[model samples]
Target: MYLTPSMAKLVHEFNKLPGIGPKTAQRLAFHILKISATEARVLASAIIEVKDRITNCPICYNITEDSPCSICKDTTRDHGLICVVEQPSDIIAMEKTRVYKGDYHVLQGAISPLDGIRPDNLRINELLMRIQQEKVKEIIIATDSDVEGEATALYLERLLRTMVARVSRIAHGIPIGSNIEYTDEVTLSKALESRRIL
Candidate 1:
């Protein structure tokens, strides 16, 4: 069956999003059609507004409508400690925990040789500059536990060792409620390796 040209275009656009298959795109287009015109307009306006207004913070590269994001402007956060992450979303996740009371450095992307993403493609130079200029005392590598993340963490470790700060990797282990049977081998190994007597 042939969809109307506009509806077909909407489905195609939705399909371009990450993890959105053709079927899912079609479903989303139809769902949007079912919504009130005002609500749909609001959604479209929000998307446009974000693309139009959002800009990366100059200091940390986190996405925000302002030059320096609210986090950077906040005086209570520990500027001496920086948590390095692979993406802006990862910073959001860490902030949601409300336990990390420090600044952040968003790499924007990871170094994945398979995808031709190298160190130059990320914000590594900015991080090093920040460390040197700010006299940062601690760096927490909060990159993912995957191969790329691990490689980035190791690279940062060596780089920061020569600086005036202590560097540490975030500990990995099992989730609070996850069962041992469902846990991955890497997590199990890390948990055992970082085990504490307490």
Candidate 2:
């Protein structure tokens, strides 16, 4: 039987999300259909609220309700050393380890020339500006161990060589081609502790 218009539409929308296949999308759409109208409304409202209320932290480029973000505002965090990651999710993962006391800078994306993403496309310039303006002493590149991430970190290392701040790369305890978010807490903590100078 042909699917109804609304069901088809919902499935299409769900399919647009990352890693959600057509089968999973259909399952979710049907699941939503079975839920109470109030619950569905709550889910929809939650999604809308995030879009309307949450924003990128201007200082670190992480997602937050505030422009500066909690990490940037926290007095206890080390302002002299900054951990640089490719995305906001990576920052969240690192924070979960609770071993990192330094502030962070989300590069927003990695350099992938094959995909047309370049240094100019990322927040690299913003990082450089922050290092200079804040007199940052060290930068730990915690980007993913994938090819694109490696390329991005190398590019940053080269650009930061002449700068006063010491540049370092996060340890390779994380599997090659794996993102930080997937790494375990112990591994992440060790990576932070064993970070090597570039």
Best by TM-score: 1
lDDT of 2 by residue, 1-198 (tens): 478998999999999999999999999999999999999999999999999998888889999998789999999989998999998989879999999999999898999988889899998889888987997888999989888998888998998978945899876677779999999998898788887789
Which residue window of length 10 is worst by lDDT in model 2?
Answer: 164-173
After superposing all C-alphas onto the true structure, candidate 1 shows an RMSD in angstroms of 1.3
Q: What would the TM-scores of all predictions be?
A: 0.95, 0.86
Candidate 1: which stretches are off by over 4 Å?
none
Taking the candidates one at a time, how many backbone clashes does each contain? Answer: 0, 0
Error of 1 at 47 (Å): 0.7
lDDT by candidate, in order shown: 0.91, 0.90
lDDT, candidate 1, 143-184, per-residue tens: 998899999888888877978558998998999999998999
| Clash pairs (backbone) in predicted model 1 | none
- For model 2 the TM-score comes to 0.86
